[model samples]
Target: MRRLLGRRDFRTIFIALTVSMLAESVLVLALGVWVKDLTGSDGLAGATFLALSAPMLVAPLAGWVVDRIPRRAIFVALNVVTAGLLLPLLTVRHAADLWIVYTVAVGYGLSYIVLGATVSALVPELVPADLLPDANSALQTVKQALRLLGPLIGAGLFSLLGGAKLALACAVCFLVAGVMGTLLRSGRQAVRMPTTSDRPTWSSEVSAGLRHLVREPALRTVAVCSALSMIGLGVGESLYFAYVDQGLGRDAAFLGILVSAQGVGGVAGGVASALVVRRLGEVGAVAVGIGLFALGSLALVQPALWLALPASVLIGMGLPVSMVGTNTLLQRRTPAHLLGRAATALDALVSGPQALAIGLGAVLVGVVDYRLLFGAIGVAMAFVGGTLWFARRVAQPAVSTEPAPAQADFPG
Candidate 1:
């Protein structure tokens, strides 16, 4: 813990990212609520979120840029673009046109990937090697906290002034994020240039990341676990607002409470994840994390909304636990130059399934009850955990505290 506190640059980056995320979380909720008010249709609001998720398929090109291009520029430019998008959003006088809201959300989805991959990839460059697990845990915990709090604030503000004002607030938040992102500018030189994975064609590059990932036994297992989790959790959360409103028969405040509770859980998990890794070994900790996620997801099956709080918390913690463990393994296994490509590869796997899950969730919510949906999520999670266990005993693990001589070290 003390070692984690010592990484000043990582801490700075963490603070910048956390504040940005907090504001973003609030703004997003506020924007959706405003859209609902304007259109007088929950369906349009749903459309907006779907639009946001729709861009996942197009993300590899963006991921390619993230890897090849400079980190600072990606972070800075994406922030500026986001801020610019939000500025026009402030003028959304009438959300009556579903298309308009959809367009804005599309902008959000496109810009979202830039910051996500950039920030995560950049952190390893800033922190000490040994402290990465702790740093990752520390960073994720803070973002989780912001995610919890952002909505309540957004909802509260929305209650006060309504539409244009909400847009302005969200715009200002983006502007703030842009400014904060600039403060963490370690510049392009901070990240070492990665090796060429392919002949630089977009499709070929995508394939390279995929091929490299497939060749590694450990990363493949991690991918399966994370992707399945996304399917279940993604499906559940996609319809969560409606679920809370209908299933739990709760009011808005109760919904906000559950969201915050999840954030609290995320922070708890992030803070503890490193310790879990340190004590449990990467495999043990990750398995436990996935198990928790599956169980927490099952909580959505509960009749009482309050009862789902622990489940939300469990979901929150599980995210960082699995992420940190998986990422750390990748760093240790992949060569320094291939790390970015390797990450982009993993992102595609995670994102593609989630994109599909979002559409699936949209369709499923119409027929299946939230309880049954959560049950399906739990079953999917079991598949993931089962795969991991089977893979562990048979295949070679990609990572270890001590490097193995049989496998290549740092795939240069």
Candidate 2:
């Protein structure tokens, strides 16, 4: 970990990403809260997240753009542009100006996809393969840690000052992140240019990432298991509210305590993720993460506060461990030119279904018993974890035929 952080480029990227994500964490909750305050409508407030996530439907396009640009340049540009985009929110004083908030939310979503793809592609250039897990872990840890404080800070600021002031603060964070991005001394490789005869069709170009994900055995396992796990996650998203209100006999405020507990666990998980990957291998680490998440789900079935708190912690711990393994594996296996596409492809596969499941769970929670739902989610996640563990035994190692980039050191 120390050695990985010693690299100047990686350190710079780390700080930049941390600052950027802090802004993201702060703004996301504030956006929803601001909308709720403006309209006094829960449905409209909920729509804020929909606006933020809707751009994911265009992730393929975003990924294609990421691949076409110099990643470092795009990373810096996106931060500056995102800061400018947030300035519109300052004008959102009335319900009539709600469009500004939603528009900016869409911009936020697009920036997230582009920046995420850029970073996934850029990180390999900044770190050695042997240190990839550590680098990813460090980044994930800081991001997770911010979840514990960023929202609280944003909420407090919004309450003390105003939504416009909060927006300005978040914009400043992005600008600072852009400054950090300028300090990156590496990841400046030339973009890949296809020859006329070898040029891909638009459809093929867009689907390239998905095709590669299906073709690669390790990535395939990770994608499949991760998608399966998302089913549980999506269902849990809606059902958790019910679990707290009815199952635990608690008010909505208590939900914050559970989330805080999860954040603490997430911090610990991020800190330990590199070691988990080192000992278990990427596939094994993901399996364990999913399994732990399943255990957390099962604990929720008991409805006791004691079980719920610990369960939230376990659930929190599982996500970072699995994500670190997934990111490290993707970086190690993907070709430089395809990294952006591959990363977005995986994001779409996992997040799309999770979004749908949130809707489905919202419907099901109304008609079905919460305990039955929790149990089913846990069992399904456990099955997915077990499937990955078994599949790892026979999975073939990744062997890319594409020539390596001259500047980047991608591991086989």
Candidate 3:
């Protein structure tokens, strides 16, 4: 961890990523609260998440774009463009302007996909392959830590100022992130520069990520499980507002407490992730994470503050554990050239179902009991964990064809 922090480029990229994620976290929470305040409907609040996540369905194309350009340029340009796009949200004043908010959410989601792929592709260039797990964990830790403050600040700001002001503030944060990204200094030799000659057609480029993901057994298994886990996540997203309003008898600002509690779990999970991976291997760790998350969601079925608070913490811990393990697995198995597309492929798979699930849950929340919704989510995640366990018996270790450079301290 100390050695990874010593690298200048890693530090720059980490700071940029942290700042951008902090702002994004705040913006997402704020948007949810804003929509709920305007409409007083759980379904509408969930719709905001649906719009934010729906663009992930196009992540393969976004991934191809990430690979096609110089990553540093992609990183800088995305933040700058996202900031400009968010500026239009300042004019959103009434229910009629909600369409603009949803539009911006889609744009935000698309940029997130592209920038996320760029980050994955850029990490190997910035740090030694051996340090990948620790580096990835550190980034997750920082992002999670910010959750403690981001949600509280966002909710408070939204209450104090309006949504328009919050949107402007989030836009400024993106501008700062863009400036920070430009400070990163990865050498051309370290980065796999995309060539124009013999470039595949657009469709081929889009499918390239999917084919590569399908070819790797471990990667494929993890991607499937993660997608399943995301369905459970969507259930929670739709019902969270109702849970806070009815279960906890609180206003939007109280989301800060739940988010901060989750951050506590995230910190522990991030710190313990490498050790977990070392002991259980990536596949086993993912199963454990899914199980833990399922247990946490089941806990949420109880409406008491004591149970819900701890449940949030459990959820926080479980999610990061799953994500870190899966991410390390992908980085370890994927070739350098395919990293961007592979990351996006996984993104699309995981987030696509989640987006749809959010919409479904949103509708369900209006008609069904929130407790029943949570129970169904918990059962689904447990089933996925069981499926992974059963499949583990039949799954063979993938043959290692990685170049020698990637073999060093690879976490596979």
Q: Which candidate has the top score in TM-score?
A: 2
Q: For residues 136-215, what per-residue lDDT tens digits would candidate 2 score against the true structure?
A: 89988998899888889889988987899899989998999998898987777688888999998998998899998999
Model 3 CA lDDT for position 326 = 81
TM-score to true structure, per model: 0.80, 0.95, 0.81
lDDT per residue (tens digit) for residues 279-390 in model 1: 7655556666787778887777776756677877888778778777776666555644355567767887886887788778888888888678888887778667666755
Order the candidates by lDDT, highest first: 2, 3, 1
Q: Mind giving the per-residue lDDT tens digits that candidate 3 earns over 99-153?
A: 8888888899888888889888777767765676787788778777877777778
Shift in Å, residue 79, candidate 1: 1.7
Q: Where's the lowest-lDDT run of ten residues in candidate 3?
A: 403-412
Please identify which of the two predictions, 2 or 3, would achieve the higher TM-score against the true structure.
Answer: 2
Q: What are the lDDT figures for the candidates, one per model? A: 0.69, 0.88, 0.80
Model 3's C-alpha root-mean-square deviation from the true structure amounts to 4.8
Segments in model 3 whose C-alpha atoms lie over 4 Å from true places: 32-48, 90-102, 159-165, 187-200, 236-260, 298-307, 359-380, 386-412
For candidate 3, give the lDDT.
0.80
- lDDT (Cα, 0-100) at 249 in candidate 2: 91
